[model samples]
Target: MDVKLPEGLEAFLAAAGWGDAVIEPLAGDASFRRYFRLRLGEQSAMLMDAPPPTEDPAPFLRAAKWLDANGLRAPRILAEDAPRGLVLLEDFGEVRVREYLDQWPADEAEVYRAAIDALVELRRLPPGPFLDYSLAEYQREAKLFVDWYCSARGLDVDAASYSAAWEEVLSPMLPRQRPGVVVLRDYHAENIMLLGSLGDQGLLDFQDALVGHPAYDLVSLLQDARRDVAPELEAQMLDYYLSKTGAGADFTADYARLGAQRNAKIVGIFVRLWKRDGKPRYLDYIPRVWALLERDLAHPALAPVARWFDANVPAGLREAGGGSWQP
Candidate 1:
């Protein structure tokens, strides 16, 4: 099998000292970036092919540095060719936690414990070099539910008021008054690489990290939209996080709000990926996400958003437009 190289990417790999390595292209996410696994003898590394105009490697570079400094296992930057949007990175290897779970079902609790521990460790770092996950940003993101998803479904309602409702509810919950910890926006099982039997995890797809509510990443982990985390485990993990962090009583409410917020954004993003970006596989995850969204809305803290749903969206439409519900 042959893999086409992005323009100038081959030259960069050579200059970066991997000219003779075997390059195996890996499946990329819903972005313009591409990754190649380069193996030469016992030495292995990953090469990023993030093209210009559509993508930038700087955020990933900055994030990698910050994560490594904070004792997380982000891939080390072995070499860089920023002008051509290529970076040689230390390969963290395969075996995503989600994949690992397929064979080791009993390790579920311990694996989530490690992930939650990573989040706790991350919260200790001082915020720097990241966008504040302010109310405006949250509103902008949540509005995606109205923009792409609603339009795709042809569901016409008050999108403006929808945003207002979000602002009214979230302004107090995730108030823009202060700074926050760095949030790896897509922290989930797929993005977490299970490095060893010792329960270490490697972070990936963190170029979109931002300063946001500490609960945001936690919800991203436990209430993953792409995969179903057992409700029992989810509850235990939440308790574990709260116990270790000693957060106030508002912690549960915060988790529910951000969970709803993130899932709604993902609903829109999945639709956009299909209708605009021509990727339809994400639609299969909608039912999973909708289930998570419904659970989040059930929280009393989300009554305002729930009322909006009850009034605007019918029960059947709540799960409408979703593909096959996978377990």
Candidate 2:
């Protein structure tokens, strides 16, 4: 029954004349950000409490402005308390693309197509000065698997070997990054809302946007760790996005390679969430990540990384996170 806000958040809302609004806590994602739905009669807005030192709201503010300017539905910013890391934002309603798909499974294609179109629109934005999501940076991410996951299992996988394998796998693909492609690092259903007149996607959690490979966001959608997008539909969506786009014909290989790298990093991240952050919810997603990793590794371009995993990672380790991952 304690609906009271914390860390001056209640005072912040009260100052905004929303002290009487009914605030309902919303389920948060894997990040440290917290959210609440503030309702004042029929009018409503979203409250983002990203208390700093642990979380920052500046990037969210910047990305939202740029995305909105570019015509993507990034939620209009209503108000902000920067020092406190609180912001009131335009609510994109309650229907997420994921929830919509659950309600009308028949509209799967239409829903996903809208999301793709939003991505196509966003791909045109001139990227900001965020950190480059470079191969070297990702190689460090892959080392998380060696540092935490392998260590947890009491295996001594050489970090140098792991980084070397990533290098071999990514060497052919790194320089191929599509210039100006502002990859919204997390573009999956959970963060995308189904809304607006064009029925297109509304984006969320893109404060970490970075300049990177074009296929990165697309792979994020199709190879979602949160939900299973049927393989056939995944292929269709991929084909749909590529048909009219100017990406090279061999972009499919690039997509698969990025997918492999992303998934590899995610598996390690999920493991770290368990071991370091003490958040075990992500542990359930590891098998799903492994399945995507398997699919990505299937690509000929991922041979070195695939071979590395096959040789260094034991069968028991592969099966540690229990879930059914099929081809």
Candidate 3:
């Protein structure tokens, strides 16, 4: 289905004297928003079309400013029409971390290290109201995986049991965290660009950045949904981060717990993308995530939730299969 451009988009471009540019549709996410790559002579820009009622572009604009101010590489907002929910941004090119790694696996460690470095730098930024990375918010977002995926699967999960187990694992872990800093909620391969000369990786789709756990972003990048980062590499990266931060010995255990939590939440999110958004492509990433979740469960840190899932989530539901439930 073709997406209708918001009213006055043509005028906006014309007023900016970009009317001669060629606009082509780019890939989009599950949200109602759409992206178009516009070419004007030697210059290029990304056009965001986020229809109102279902999508708003304010968060993206606000986050762009915040990231730019804090020494990150979010897209620069070239123009905006908030009432029409349209914005034009500088194009970051098409060299996502995933593509770069696929072409040059040898550079994975270096690329990932740079990505982590950017994340660490982001963590140094002071807190702000625009960034809400509190524990309650994290728990709420994590529960989305359960609500959308588990419920859709018709699994009989005892909410109180699940909640209690989550608290048992996460509550103590929370206070052990050092001072809060900005966290790119989805700092994965897909959202990073490997610009050749650009010292820092280009950050994209960070409208949901928050002030929370220092390890959360690291977990997201290393335990990515699309790529298979080796165990040795993952361990080395974790250690590298620890050395940089000078976190305590318990940091390893906390990292494992956070990884397990993040993987489980992603599993539900992938399933939800398929079941709710009619985007079944996300289902392909489920097995890898499940493996990560199970691996994290093996860690002594996640014993409670691991035990609960092993007993409750049913053996058949552990893997992806065809068939939809009426419920």
lDDT of 2 by residue, 86-106 (tens): 999998888887877787899
lDDT of 2 at 52: 87
Q: Write the per-residue lDDT of candidate 3 for residues 1-327, one digit (tens) a residue.
A: 565565788998987778899888877886778998899999999898987878888887888888888778888888888778889988889988888789889888888778778866766677644654556765776686678777777677776777678778887777765467677778898889766653557888877766677788888898887899888999999888877778787777877888887887887787788787888888777778888887788888888887888777776766543223332
Residue-level lDDT for 294 in candidate 1? 91
Q: Estimate each model's TM-score.
A: 0.95, 0.92, 0.92
lDDT of 1 by residue, 174-198 (tens): 6532567889989999999987763
Candidate 1, which ten residues in sequence have the lowest lDDT sum?
318-327
Q: lDDT scores for all predictions?
A: 0.85, 0.81, 0.78
Native-referenced Cα lDDT, model 1:
0.85
Give candidate 1 misplaced runs (Cα > 4 Å): 175-177, 319-327
How would the candidate models be sorted by lDDT, starting from the highest? 1, 2, 3
lDDT of 1 at 95: 88
Summed backbone clashes in each candidate are: 0, 0, 0
Candidate 1, residue 318: Cα displacement in angstroms equals: 1.6
RMSD of each: 2.3, 3.0, 2.6
lDDT of 3: 0.78
